[model samples]
Target: MRTFQHKVTINDMGAITIFGLGAFFCLWNRTNSLMVILGCLLIIVTIRAVDRAIHTSYVLTDDSALQIKTGRIGLTKHILLSEVKSVEKRPFAFHLGHYALIEMMNGSVVSVQPDNVDSFLSALKKRIEKKDNEV
Candidate 1:
């Protein structure tokens, strides 16, 4: 199995900024319970997002499947390699980070943000080829 780490991206930074704004708004509008609650929830989500990005990884299993895990909520997802039709890399304009769009045979696409695009793609392609040869 091959595993690759998830990279921190500008979107994550934007999320943090949004959470900060929410907190600021809550403080500005004092005595508003709903605003305060939303701000708190934002903070929790931001924290979990950052933590998940740092701790989570994309795994290519030996059984012709890809395993994605999120550390924040211990969430895991699996995708069969044979079902993957294509992988398109969508990079940021200035190289902040990239997302790979995995197209499935069912005409659904799943996007994954990983730290190193080459590593992720190479490993995925290798596994797909390996699985194809076995069949």
Candidate 2:
């Protein structure tokens, strides 16, 4: 099994912190309860997103077949390597962050965002090559 793990980048942290602080300050100064509630929700969302970003990891295992697993939200997705048709790194758009599109031969696509995009791509490519060689 080969594993690739990465934490949220400093840049991501800084952005999240700025957003959280802004919401907190707005909540503190606002007199409306609805505004305050919205601010609180925003803060919660930001924190959760940051935590997930930092904690997410991916693992690839080679047996008779290949298995890919991604960890997040106390759950892991197991995918067979033979099912994967291709992997493509797409450009960051909006809040999506850097994404890897795992295209399956059956025409299913799974989108994943890893903290260190370059390393994730490299590791995925290596695993794909290894799986292909085994076949």
Best by lDDT: 1
| Pairs of residues at least 3 apart in sequence or in different chains that clash in candidate 2 | none
- The 10 consecutive residues of candidate 2 with the worst lDDT sum are 64-73
The lDDT for every candidate, in the order shown, is: 0.83, 0.70
| Per-residue alpha-carbon lDDT of candidate 1 for residues 25-110, written as tens digits (9 for 90 to 100) | 77678687887787778778777866776788898887889998977577898999999999878877687667888999999998
lDDT of 2 by residue, 1-135 (tens): 666664455566877888798788868888888878878888877776676666766666655233333335546667777677888888665655677888889898887766676777787777778778978
Reference-based TM-score of each model: 0.85, 0.65
- Candidate 1 local Cα displacement, residue 17, angstroms: 2.8
Q: Count of backbone clashes for each model?
A: 0, 0
CA lDDT, candidate 2, residue 6: 47
